[model samples]
Target: MEFRDLNISESIMERLDEKGFTEATQIQEKAIPIVLDTELDVVGQAQTGTGKTLAFGIPIIQKIQEKIEENGRKNKKAVKAIILTPTRELALQVHDEIDSVNKGNKLRLCTVYGGQSIEKQINKLRNGVDIVIGTPGRVIDHLGRRTLKLNEIDFLVLDEADEMLNLGFIDDVEEIMSKCKEDCRKLLFSATLPKSIMELVELHMGEYETIRVKSKALTTELTEQIYYEVKEHDKFELLRRIIDKEPGFYGLVFCKTKADVDQLMRRLNDENYSSEALHGDMNQKQRELALSRFKSHKIDIMIATDVAARGIDINELTHVINYDIPQNPEAYVHRIGRTGRAGNKGTAITFVEPREFRRFKYIMKISKSDAKKEKIPDVTEIVELTKTNIIGKLKQLIQTENSEDSEDLENYEFENLEIVDELIELADSKVIIDKLISQLFKEELNRKSYGRIGDYGSRKGNDGRDSRRDGRNDRDRRDGRRNDRDRNDRNDRNDRDRRDNRRRNNDGGSRLFVALGSMDNMDTRRLLRKVLEKSDVSKDNISEVNVYRNFSFISADEKTAKQIVDSFRSERRNGKPLIEYAKR
Candidate 1:
């Protein structure tokens, strides 16, 4: 049924329409009605992207009729609803969905998750919020700090319950739930109702309604899942070819580490692919900017590590490519779940090194995806793919460009035909394409004389040799190394420090525009001392502290700025702190 049928606000319905959501998925269809009817507990069994968020969110938003009060004003700062997810990513996703649905409504949403300053979250709480969506750890942290008051919570939601269990967050989830009022409305969503989840339901829920919607079952008809075994070294080149050949497809490439994400991003950029990176190391603002660009279709691919991609929900994901196989089956599910959402057709491809074949099989078995194998594309195939991609892009360019003028049309026609002819001659047909692909594969094989994918040092259980090399050299110097080596160590440290200092002090931490009142009542020295005491900053880290008539700014390293943001998040600082990465 339509979102409007759920009796949600008109603005929310409009948002759903804009997001291209019309009919409710099975989970939403069943759970929304039950949730809207009463404050009774709900237990929904469904995988990710089964419209679970809207299922509970619509009811939570509709039913929570609490009066919000803030700062001697009759306003509601006490949250009417709380949603807990296992990861910061999932938490943010749920929060964004709820926010989209509650657009134009008087709901003040806040998210609490790790990999961020808890003090910052506490400050958000102090600013007042009506709904709290967070990870279990951060939520519990807030509870301990007395920043998150759940006693007044009317609705409590446990999303991705199985993930929470798998992540060992069940205990933290229970603790956070215990802080909620006894009569609070409770709802839980999970892919499977394992024994642990059932136990949680039994212990916490009251007169709950149950709804089950199997994601794999629903998606099997519309989606394709496949894996290709390639050498680890060849994955990047393979991904580039696939991206070139896949017409009209927007994709995500998941990497295992932030460094991988950055490396892949740079590679894609250098190769002229419209791409961006997302990782936990990036701040919330950076993550938001990247996501925004991606959603706006400014970027074709997002190279991300899982940690940084928590809480991201993009409905139009056509493909999910595992550049590196996920560490766990659950992660495999999560990564692929980004696609095949809302009853849409999607594809998930995993690149498995020969050594990782067994791990891939295990993941397939655990996830129970209807996965099949794909042969590695040979060199001729890669060349043909590159040609095909160029042709496709040319066609698109011509299609969108204004061709009103005869001369423009003639130029486009000639240019298109020329490109097409060149591509056709390069690899005439599928047979020739395969031949070219094979030839390129052979060339690659010959060039990689040092190692093959399966025989790479990565598969030999060697880790972090790169990180240890510098230390080894340093130790050698301390043990009476040659004069040259000693000189190198001194220069290396200076260079390293210079680079580190540049990254932190891009704009030279000068002044902070603090948002506080009554400068005369504020002591600059005392505030600086307090900031230092509350944060992880050392005295030597700060160069100076400047206080103006209305605000205070600090000069320090980027690390020190982060420390201040973390420490003084809950403290009453006079004015807004300019605690951000300074620009060059």
Candidate 2:
């Protein structure tokens, strides 16, 4: 259905057409008429990328404009509508998309979120806005400051209410709603209708109309789904290898937590891969810069957590890799929906650990999506593909003899044409050509240039698929291997036995005691990573890390040591302080 069919005015229809929104989606086609004609509250259930913003945005703008014309410019800057989102990214996205539809009108809009100056936001609010798009926390802050008055708002929208519930913002949402006009027409939109969402509807939208539309991406037909069963330790190796296998891979990779995103992004950048991290910890400027780089193709891969990835719409994404499989099938569907958008073909790849195979199967069954087992390609195979793909992209560039390509590539190889002819005559023709080609792609053509990926033939069964077992059993095996490694390094343990002498001498370094050890999930690598992340310490400046059953110690420069000590006052993991210096 088209916007014109929904009784939208010619002016608004012209704006929609200019933005290429010719056809109305299921929710838009159904909900637009109700909002434009009726006074009942609405609850719209649709997929993430299913044009939910426009569904409510169009009617809101039209209704506001109609009110303005009917009332004769009396409430020019009076707040009439408020749209609340779960995150800052989603807030900005809604504001931008709706602003496009509200263009050429006298309507005013402002977006408020944390990580920006509150004073600036206050100034914007005082300037008399018609519509406001913001996150819950910021909206509550504005209300407390007495800068934003919602009592005059005629419409209130809770976008992504399920996400708001997951983020523990439902309480805040209720508080904001309580402060709104009692008779305001409320609209609730979410991808899912959890019990909490229904509770919200019962409390606020007593007489609401509902619209639920199932999008085709839920089945994932346009995406080729594949999974490789690998151990947790070998997942990074497989990830790197798969990345090398596809030369044109440009997409997002999902991690389960922010720390995982940071660690994986660090490893990828260390290996010279174009990548960046997006998570809740990053400031708004940093997140915007990372997103800008990803969209402009300056980086080929973006590592993000699920919460941080909400409201991102990149229609040309080629792939979506699940580095950590989501816990539920709905979350899985949401992650894979990033690709196969705008009718483009895409691929969804997942790495299932030994213990996750059954859970993954359950997800597949619940979502009714088909996934095939794929093996990690060999290094030699990746090298061959790299050469072939690179040649395919640059073949026309090297065709110097062709004079038909717009001034012949605009003089790309024109200067080298005479030299090529001279060189061909100076040596055997085929020998010269082969030597030139090999030298041209020296790094890409070399098998050793690609790093080593582990061999897992022993882990595969007779059927050429992974031999699955409990991850706890695999951990036991790894523990046994660690014990052997410790036994082999007894000489290093003997060095630690001379602890008193080193503590007194200090070896021109400071030895600090850590409050955690093996029992608290402490280890040399993990402790080092935590310390370096919290402070300005260089890895080379630290040494002599020793972990015991209940405590640990490490040596670093006095500056790094003091920074680490000060950082722990606020730094924590899983709500527990990670480090504390000895009382001396």
Candidate 3:
């Protein structure tokens, strides 16, 4: 349905046209008329990228405008509505979106959130605003101080209600809703409605219409799902290979944690990749700057955690790389959904470690992800692709330079041509051409780490079989245990590292033993890496790792080996250490 056909005013319709909001999305088409004509509360269920804000905002704006028209300027200046979001970034996003529809003249909005001055927000509320967009915690602070009043608010919107629920904002949300006028038209919009959301609807909403926009699936068909079987340590190396394979790679990469997001982002930036990081630790301004850079194509990659990525507004993206596999199937879908949007084809790639393959299998079963197993492209292949791209750009430039109709021609080309004529006289054409092409090839492919990824050949975990005699319990246990361990490790990282690498010798000559070898798919290199991940055991400590069918032997200090064994004890099956112990 079209926006013009809706009962919205001509001026608003004109504004929509100017902003290119021509057709109503499925949710908007179904919910707009209901909202515009009724005073009843509403529950709109739709995905994040769907136009949920516009659906409710259009009617809310018109209704607020209507109330103002009837009640005089007093209604215009009063706070008539409040929209609550889960995060500060999301609050700002909702505010900007609604303000765009309102044109900021008829309606005033104050967005309050943490990390900003509470005094500033209080003053804005004191000055009387028509609408408030804020996160739950900040909004509650205002409510407690009585600086913001919602008693007269005619509309209360809980956007991203599920996200709020996940963030433990139910009580705060309920309190905020209770403060609104008894007859206020409440609206709850969420991608997924948990039990708590429905409970809120039943408790606070009367005669509310539940408008669900049915999903074709959690993931779209436009996305091609592929997984590369790579070791954990080589994940970054494989990522760079993927980037090199595609000369114009532009995408969002999802990491499991904020630290991971920062770590990957720093590495990418260090390697001269145009990249930015978005996560919870950054203040609103920094997040906005990173987002702005990504949107404007100043950066080609945005490395972000799942929560911080919620506020992303990009419609077209080329790829979504799961640098660390998400434990939740829905999360995997959510991450991939960021790409292959606006009807454009996108690629979603997962770098699955051997240890993670079992969990990946379970996620696939639950989410119905049809991710194909793909081998990471070899270094030679990436180099060849890079060379081809360089030559392709060179050919394109030559074509543009030679064409009379080409307006993109640089004036510098003429000057370069004069120099080229002189060079042609001074040297053989073949030599000059060879050197030029060679220089371009070297410059493009000179990345030192480009060819360093190991070939973890043809490990297909695509059969949905448990890689490690894994069951549902084991899967659940692994997820929960890993999460707990990672959180604990982050808290006392230095202490934990020291503990993991207990008695280290200056010479690094001690040897240790580990159980479960080739049969468990554990090789010398992989076993050594596993030790290093959990311990401060340097590579020098483990000079040679010898693997047998059912056990392995490695080098480590006597106490360091004991500590490594204790560290992985939780991973033990049949009451063995996670990494079995042996005295040298």
Candidate 4:
């Protein structure tokens, strides 16, 4: 049904029209009315990408608007609502969606997540924000710091509740709930109603109204599901071949971990494929940049972990490749759901290792997807496909050029008449075409060789040794030497640092306590990226990044450290500061 029929305010309706959201999805339709008209808490069960954000967002904004109208805008600074998500990406996405709906209505909203400046979030809170969207970790950080007060919160939303439980944020969520106004309306949304979710609801929500929107089967008729049984080591090669064989290929490749995402992206780029990595290890800006590049076609492939890939919406995506299959069948459904959208045909291909066959079958059964086992195309077949694609393009070009009228041709200038005449004299059209095709075949062969996709079989060298084995040995030796050199350099640097510390009594550098670490999916690169993005600190100015469970410390020169503190003292991670001078 139309959103206008739901009695949405003019301001919200206008924003929806601008966003091209005329009809609401099932969850939105069912949940919006209950949220806007009732005082009872809601438990909404729907799959991902079903517009859960706007379902609760619209009503939340409307309620805040009503409160403002009754009490005047002076109460705008007080946070009236908070939305908790399992990941920083989801939090940002929810904030963006709700903020867009609140356009012209003027609701002050802020997003809090780790790997960002906590002080900035605190400042935003201090100035007064109507809504705060954040992850559980960052929310807990703010709660402990007393920078975020929920005593006056009118609405509290737990989005992706099952995910939060999976990530072990249930305790934090319950704690956050305890600090909120006892009468605050709670809304819990999840793809599945796990036992943990039911327990959470029963404990926190009294007499909640349940809304269930049954999701369609995971595999859609518009999407062709296929799987290739390949050795783990050969997966990359197979991926390369598929990309080469498909014309104008754009895909989202899902990996299992941040390390897998990074390594796969590196390998793809090294093979001359345009790609970017998205994982929890990347800070917010990096994640946004990667998504931007993917959307703009600056990169053709987005290599992402399942968690980092959540809440990312892109149209015109042709395929979803499971570089590593997800353990959860529901996750598999979500990954493939990124494509085959809006009636456009899409393909989902999963690379199944031999050891994973049983699990893969379980996934197929649970997802109800009729995935056919597909054989990987050999290099020769890929080369032939490439040739056929090129010839098809050439034919189209010829047809377009020849389709012009004789009068149009008469108006064209013959800039190279003699060159054409000489070519015609040397060779007939068939000979010329044959020569061109030969050149294209040779070029495709050369490219395949360069990409190493053509070297699936073993080859022997002139010295009676396998060339592949020799290559591996050479690479191992190089890696060993590099490791040795790095070890030696690290030892020398440690020695120098010890001597310097003794001389300066540890006064030469300062340490800062950042409120992010392993729990927030932070790493050295992400920490460095966050520092560089939020402050003027360079890579060389920061050192000794030691991450812990809930916090981290970094050492820098006194001057640089002071600048960092000054820049980030008002910033936050998740919703707390990422840096502070080490407590002496």
Best by TM-score: 4
Candidate 1 local lDDT, residue 341: 79
The top-ranked prediction according to lDDT is: 4
Q: Which ten residues in a row are the worst by lDDT in model 1?
A: 444-453
lDDT of 4 at 227: 84
**lDDT against the true structure, each candidate:** 0.68, 0.76, 0.75, 0.77
Clash count of each predicted structure: 25, 0, 0, 19
Tens digit of per-residue lDDT, candidate 4, span 192-242: 898989988999887689999886765678889998867665788789888
lDDT for each residue of candidate 2 in 1-584, tens digit (9 for 90 to 100): 87788999777888888866789989899889989999999999876556788889999999988988888667555789999986665677688778878877758899987655668889988878999998787788788878899988889999878766765677779999999999999999887788889988998775889999984546557888998877675787688788888878998999987899998897777556899999989998999999999999999999998768874789888989999987456568778989988899899999887666655765675466788888778877888888788778667665545645645455454567888779978999889968877877654575544434444445555332343354333222221121133223344446765774565436555767777888987666566656765674665456446777888887666666677778777865557555655544
lDDT of 1 by residue, 1-584 (tens): 77777766566677788777888888888898787766578898876546677888877775653233223325456777888876655676677668877876667889876555556778888988888988776677677768889887778888878766765567778888889988988888887788999999999889988887755642354568987767654676678667755757698999977898998887666445799999878887998999999999999899998756666798888999999888555578778878877888899999876555544554565467667766655545555665665567657765664545424645444646766577788775786656655565432222221111232333223332432353234333321122223345556767977886565456544333455423645444455545654674664566545555665566676566677776655654445333433232
lDDT of 4 at 2: 94
CA shift at 458, candidate 4, in angstroms?
19
The residue ranges of model 2 lying beyond 4 angstroms of the native Cα positions read 72-77, 214-219, 226-243, 247-346, 349-381, 384-438, 445-584
Question: Candidate 4, after superposition: displacement of residue 303 in Å?
Answer: 12
Ranking by lDDT: 4, 2, 3, 1
| Pairs that collide, model 3 | none
Poorly placed runs, candidate 3 (over 4 Å)? 75-77, 226-240, 247-345, 349-440, 443-584
RMSD of 4: 17.4
